[model samples]
Target: MPIKTPDAANPCVFISAEDVGKVGTETPQELAGDLGFLSNMEMIRQAGSFRMGVTPDIAAAKQMQSVPKVAIVAAPTDAKIQSGKVLLGTDVDLVVRMISMQQPHRAVPITGALCLAIACRIDGTIPARLARATLNTLTLSQPSGTIAVDANVRYINNTPVALSGTVLRTARLLFSGLVHH
Candidate 1:
């Protein structure tokens, strides 16, 4: 099941699966592209409006709808700019445990992860990758692609505090020109 983060800034949802193939089905690949459905406000609206407890048919999380959990499922580097182009999907499938979706990216969003990072501290929250006592990074797989979120969560007085959440991304030169200031 996917849990919608309570965050209002950069809303996101987290879920778990058995493998990557099952992860991509959230959109069912009918309308979205090979990159999968775009994770943006559209997804947020769709999920927010979902009936939640009641819905005999139709999945609230479209791409994820009715897809049986089979399997589950990122990285980047620093540079002012780089040559590599961002691609959709990965060559290797994952035996992943948890996944996330954030706006402007079908993949994982660092901002989204921040919300989850804090949520993880809550008492009732199900720990992502429960097998591990500590989770330093979170791998999120979606229809379009996947990515890893770098999380630095600190604890104070048994309360979880979010220090930082980041993602490394390759940069492409979008424009290079001189401007008269």
Candidate 2:
């Protein structure tokens, strides 16, 4: 499922319940840090099983005048990490949250960033075409970072990388013999 493009000031990403339950993720701090300037240590928040936080930016302001940023990134854990499989059950509903740091005057779509992350994770490559599609469809500017093909393990309510694939394989195998002609 595609993520919705949030308003300029308060951008967020939302996926279907099914997708959220299937992907396994790393600790919120690790994902945040890996995202470079988007994560901050002090803004981290733990609510029930979900983790919420903000990113701090001193350099971004000096660098770009037209980017929507949140001094924080938040992730809610929808599944537990076990044998590289994130169970697709109702117990967990993972969602990634980010706030807009850009001045209200400048309209920047922050949810595009989250959408890009999800697209890259599912395809293992962020094609320029796809990025372009996202920009066009979401009505947002193209972000800076290039989507390099790398080994990514997004925990919690992030992307469904290799671990999610592994889990899917297992499920298919389990049903393989049962659904016979």
Candidate 3:
């Protein structure tokens, strides 16, 4: 039986088998490139936002029985410099949890980087019209894409926007001979 809501009626978003198939094939490939490189990058792209690899073992946290579960975590680092006049850019982190399990922890990096980059582009602003134009020229958007959520806070007299978010990509189901539909 189909489920129904009290006020509205239909679901917020609907994903057909075809839509799911397209998402499966195109999303990760376009976003992360090869899995090996992506994994390493996600692990290394330091700055808080990238969280694709390791997360808390929630099941373990929830359990009164067994050991419960495990998790994967990533730690990244980088170096940047502001020469001439000092410029402080807002620091943001976007995170995505692609998969989860119990026992141990792990994560993929390239996907995390791409996901964070897209999110930063979406919410960050430019100093001027010219600067914004240049940034648009240099930015790239992820295709199909991973699911990411943002956590933002303003700091230092609103001079910098500190943000953190998570992204997710789910495995697709195979049906019959076709990819999905």
Best by lDDT: 1
Of the pair 1 and 2, which is ahead by TM-score?
Answer: 1
- Number of the predicted model whose TM-score against the real structure is largest: 1
Candidate 3 lDDT, tens digit per residue, 78-173? 112112221122121211223212111123233433333332443342111111222322221222222333323345565544353333445797
The number of clashing residue pairs in each candidate reads 12, 9, 23
Task: Compute the lDDT for candidate 3.
Answer: 0.25
Please estimate how well model 2 matches the true structure, expressed as its whole-model Cα lDDT. Answer: 0.28
lDDT of 3 at 33: 43
| Runs of candidate 2 exceeding 4 Å displacement | 1-93, 102-181
Instruction: Write model 2 residue lDDT over 1-181, tens digit each, in one string.
Output: 2223323222222332233231223333333445432322112211100211112343323343223333221123333332444433232222222223322112113343444344334443322222222212221111111111222335456634333111111123444355668
TM value for model 3: 0.21
By TM-score, the candidates rank as 1, 2, 3
What's the TM-score of each model vs. the native?
0.39, 0.21, 0.21
Q: Rate the local accuracy (lDDT) of all candidates.
A: 0.37, 0.28, 0.25
RMSD of each: 9.8, 17.6, 17.6
Tens-digit lDDT string for candidate 1 (20-118) = 233323432332443443333234334443534222223544554321211122111111111233333332222122223322233433554445444
